[model samples]
Target: MVRILQQKQFVGHEIHGKSHKYYPLITKETYTKSFMKGFVRRYFSGSYRQMVSFFTKEDNLSLHELEQLLKELKDKNS
Candidate 1:
């Protein structure tokens, strides 16, 4: 079965060869800064609280990782 993570752009395809492994790669276009903003908009409502809410509900995000992402977003906007 193929699983699709709506926010995380990807198709989880299986490897035909031995030692099968999968990774999430962006769908459509390359995930540049502009693309990320759109991703954030859809997933986080372009707000800090929204981002927190997203991870809380999804229960798969790490706090430290979110903090780092927040810092990066801030740096980009500033």
Candidate 2:
């Protein structure tokens, strides 16, 4: 864990005379986006559309659910 933190350049503060407090070098949003990009690349060939299609079909999404999803997408884009 120390090695990983060092490699990732995370800042660590020595506490008392024994342990250390570690802080992330990256923000949570940055880390989550990075993780999701790798996950989608590995599982969905880097295609978000393909991932969403797979999930919709696998879950047997109803027309209303699909429409809701479409509305969400439209709202996000707009």
Candidate 3:
């Protein structure tokens, strides 16, 4: 919690009566995007394809999920 206070992007804090309260400084979507980018960079060489390939090979992605992913990609490209 103390560490979170240091990153202005992550949270804001309130001090009251010798106690501290913290609240998010960024939206959930923004934080998730930042976190996933760092995770992919650190673990998958910054390649989203490599990340998806790893999950597919590990049987982590369901067939329906894969199809949905492909559909989204196609829609994006279209």
For model 1, state the Cα shift of residue 65 in Å.
1.1
15: Cα error in model 1, Å: 28
Write down the TM-score of every candidate. Answer: 0.35, 0.66, 0.83
lDDT, candidate 3, 27-52, per-residue tens: 89997898999999999999999999
As for TM-score, the candidate ahead, 1 or 3, is 3
TM-score of 1: 0.35
Q: Number of clashes in model 1?
A: 0
- Best of the candidates, TM-score: 3
> What Cα-based lDDT does every candidate model obtain?
0.69, 0.82, 0.89
Number of the candidate with higher lDDT, 1 or 2 = 2
Q: Residue by residue across 25-50, what tens digits does model 2's lDDT show? A: 77789878988999999999999988
Ranking under lDDT, best-scoring first? 3, 2, 1
Pairs clashing within candidate 1: none
Candidate 2: C-alpha lDDT: 0.82
**Span of 10 residues, lowest total lDDT, candidate 1:** 1-10
How well does candidate 2 score on lDDT at residue 32?
Answer: 81
Backbone clash total, candidate 3? 0
Candidate 2 residue pairs in backbone clash? none
